[model samples]
Target: MAPTAFLLVFSEPGPNVPEDEYNDWYDNEHIPLRVNTPAFLNWTRWKAVDGEKPTYGASYDLESYEATKKAPYTTLAETRSDREKGILANIQLLDRRHYELIEPHPIPLRHSTTRRNLPHTSSLSPEEDFNKWYHEEHIPLLAKAPGWVRSRRFILKDCGQMGVEAQKDQKPPKYMAVHEWASMDSFKSPEYKAALATPWTEKVFANVVAKERRVMTFVRKWARL
Candidate 1:
């Protein structure tokens, strides 16, 4: 079967770097390097409205996580011009990871005003049990939240560090869920709160060894299916 994956990145400008210059390089130079690749289906950018730092996030929908380790994708960075390196040197990457789709949602990919990103790792429960809760119980409840568009889940396949002052050999959680929304209203809604209040949710989440919750608003989209 054809593989499906995501290249997710969170970042911020380095100290003394102006936001305009950082964004200019990302929009005009950095992102262009990956846009034309056939394996890359689409790319979207976002800014944090709430939650974790590094503030900026981007998602690259790809044919497979393995595509990132090959040919043009690898060559893009290896062959970066001095100017590209210069700009990269002034950026700070908070997290960079590639993940394969585990649970695909029905809603066609489209623009959304808000999103909630949950990246986590599990330790206590058996993998099957943890996933069973998410697949059979958790998502259905979350789906009932007002303004919810869709929710997709993924499993990490590869990860690496980037940018100046980047963390040394950093690693993120193994699983992630991307939840789309029409507005921020879903987060504080009764249904959303109730979803988290379930005893099953507590049981499963107790096994979540590490996690990050980031709420972001759409900034722009570069390419699409």
Candidate 2:
């Protein structure tokens, strides 16, 4: 179960915080603490150019659902330092979701196959049509394009049982689609564009909300458990 599931967090710093300081806190403190915890595998952060408000994002992979829910990641009231609180107060949380890897299942993801993270929420009621469209049509066709390594769809989990939920009352991101790429330019290819513009896709977008695409790159690396 090594690195079987992941937690996705999207955020934006408050108007008062400087970009440099926010990044410093993550690179210097936040990431290290999480990485040191048991069952954590890798962590990444990103900036979303075409995404929702407060366009920063991060994800952490864990050994299993249990490891994913373990205390090191779950309980938080007992674990905040002033530095942590200072950072929290200066940021706005956009969305948080937990997804168990559904694409490259039972197999470890190739390191760095994930270059850009495109996360979106579907507005289609019952949440099934949207997922069916993604898993059955959109992703299946899109994954064939050049540079596309793996595409994963994660559904929101009962995080109330996990350590600490970032936002207690807000509605969680119902669905998340993560497409790993070999290079940033792959997204601009004609095949990729064609894959996105279909009659079916139009119907899908009509029912989508907070629909966004983000530009993400490797920020740092850490030791794995």
The local distance difference test score of each candidate is: 0.75, 0.65
Any runs in candidate 1 off by more than 4 Å, and if so which? Answer: 1-3, 105-125
TM-score, every prediction: 0.87, 0.75
Candidate 2: stretches off by over 4 Å: 75-77, 103-129, 158-168, 206-215
Best by the TM-score measure: 1
Best by lDDT: 1
Q: What's the TM for model 1?
A: 0.87
Q: Can you list the residue pairs that collide in candidate 1? A: none
Report the C-alpha lDDT of model 2 over 85-188, residue by residue, as the tens digit: 77676555435566675555322344553455444442333367776677677776766677776676666664422212345666554556777776767778
Candidate 1, residues 1-225: lDDT per residue as tens digits? 344898888887767567888888778877777788777888778888776577898888888877878887778878887876876766666468888998675444545545443323223345788888877877788788777777788888877777776877777777788877777767789999998899988887777777767777788778632
Question: How good is model 2 by TM-score?
Answer: 0.75
Error of 2 at 14 (Å): 2.0
